[model samples]
Target: MSATQFFKISLKRSTIGLAPDYRAAARTLGLHRSHQTVYRPADSTTAGLILKLKELVKVENVASIPTSVEINAARKAARGYQVVEKQGAFTKI
Candidate 1:
């Protein structure tokens, strides 16, 4: 069987001050806030909605959907420190 494709849609701009239709389109795509990302099937209906909000969103074609863990990892901040080496008890700084 062939793998399903998805549209990785991220809201790059806010819908505020825009037409109600644009805001509704964003909501229909599950985007409630800026920078929020959502995955939807690559179909005509979704395509139309995306096209309507194209100016306010960023779209990418992904082969598969990401798991919650993967999504969380992507959104997680980098660790501030890295361990270079471990010191032995007899070693002096």
Candidate 2:
């Protein structure tokens, strides 16, 4: 099967109070907030976007684009019971 192509990009820095050009670049690349993960095609234009936002974003190569289900699964997995056990009542306690 043809492997699904995907590019993983994350916003590492805040665009607030930055130069207009830099902010525009980040916005153009669809990175409007911190810790934002955007999936893009594997191409030179995408690469250029990443480069432009490198100071404010991180670029990574991923196997494929993760769906909402996958993202939710990962978020669920990261919810440590011990960490938030005291914050809320247990559902099946």
Candidate 3:
């Protein structure tokens, strides 16, 4: 399979007090909340939006799209121990 080049943008600031145009640009770019992230194809429209909201976001280049499962797995906390009593009923304390 081939990988597509895209921009991974994370909103670093809130747009509440910004100009309406600036906020619109951020909305168009799929960024509506601080710390929220979205991926866009590497193209002029995306570039223009990024430039328009440059001060409110952080950008990075990502080479491939990860599956939803992968994304979900990445966000899950790691378990420190294995469950060895799966077949047993819970014991009363």
Candidate 4:
């Protein structure tokens, strides 16, 4: 049989102060931040994890290993501002 394919699932939100079950699921998947990724074989366990944290996690198909490229790209896309300007002017000494 061919090598097992893995899915790269990320936690898109924090479980802090949320439902206990949701937080437990996130912890089980090793997700503790807004951009945490977990690699799991395409199996029932992984599917269960997805279902458990569906509201706080986002699942996507991945070829091999998990990478930050996809997550970073998503972050940039969701950003409302490209550059933040300072309110005050700079001074010289």
Candidate 5:
């Protein structure tokens, strides 16, 4: 089977003071707040919506959708840790 593709859209601008139709298009694109990212199937209908809100969002092609767990992991801060000494080298201050 052929692999499916999707579009990763990020809201780069605000919707305030914009036309109602444009705002509606943003909502239809599943964008709720500024800087939010969403994925949609790569199709003509989605393309049309992206075109309508081209000025407010950024779009890119992605091979597949990431799971919620993966997305959360990607957004999480990295843990900084180091083993200065091995277990045999226990010391008291």
Candidate 6:
């Protein structure tokens, strides 16, 4: 079987002050806030919506949808420092 693809759509801009149609399109795409992302199958309906809100969103073609754990990991910040050693327990002399 062929592998299915998905569209990684992210709201790069806010919809405030925009036309009602544009707002509706974003809402329909499950985007409620800026920087929020949603995955949808790569299809014509999704393409039309993306075209309508192309200026407000960023779209990328992904091979597959990511799991919640993977998504969270991608959003997590990296720790810059490494732990070289642990503190030893102190004893009274």
- Scored by lDDT, the top model is 6
lDDT of 6 by residue, 13-88 (tens): 9999999999999999999999999999888999999999999999998888889999889989997988889989
lDDT of 3: 0.89
TM-score of each: 0.76, 0.72, 0.77, 0.61, 0.78, 0.77
RMSD of each: 5.1, 7.9, 6.8, 9.1, 5.3, 6.6
- Per-residue lDDT tens digits of candidate 1, residues 37-89? 99999999999999999899999988999999988899889989888999768
TM-score of 4: 0.61
Query: Tens digit of lDDT per residue, candidate 4, span 1-93?
Result: 136577778898888888888888788777878887788777888789789778878887766873579656766756476667667777988
Q: How would you encode candidate 3's per-residue C-alpha lDDT over 5-29 as one tens digit per residue?
A: 7999999999998899999999999
Off by over 4 Å in 5: 1-4, 82-93
Rate residue 52 of model 2 by lDDT. Answer: 77
Report how far residue 31 has shifted in candidate 3, in Å.
Answer: 1.0
Instruction: State residue 61's C-alpha deviation in candidate 1, in Å.
Output: 0.2
Stretches of candidate 4 above 4 Å error?
Answer: 1-4, 66-93
lDDT-best of 2 and 4? 2
lDDT against the true structure, each candidate: 0.92, 0.79, 0.89, 0.77, 0.92, 0.93
TM-score ranking, high to low: 5, 6, 3, 1, 2, 4
| Count of clashes in candidate 2 | 0
Model 5, C-alpha of 55: deviation from truth (Å): 1.0
Error of 2 at 64 (Å): 1.4
Model 1: weakest 10-residue lDDT segment is 1-10
Positional deviation of 35 in candidate 1, in angstroms?
0.5
Residue 14 C-alpha lDDT in model 5? 96
- 10 residues in a row with least lDDT, candidate 6: 1-10
Model 3 CA lDDT for position 33: 85
Tell me the spans in candidate 3 whose CA falls farther than 4 Å from its real position. 1-4, 81-93
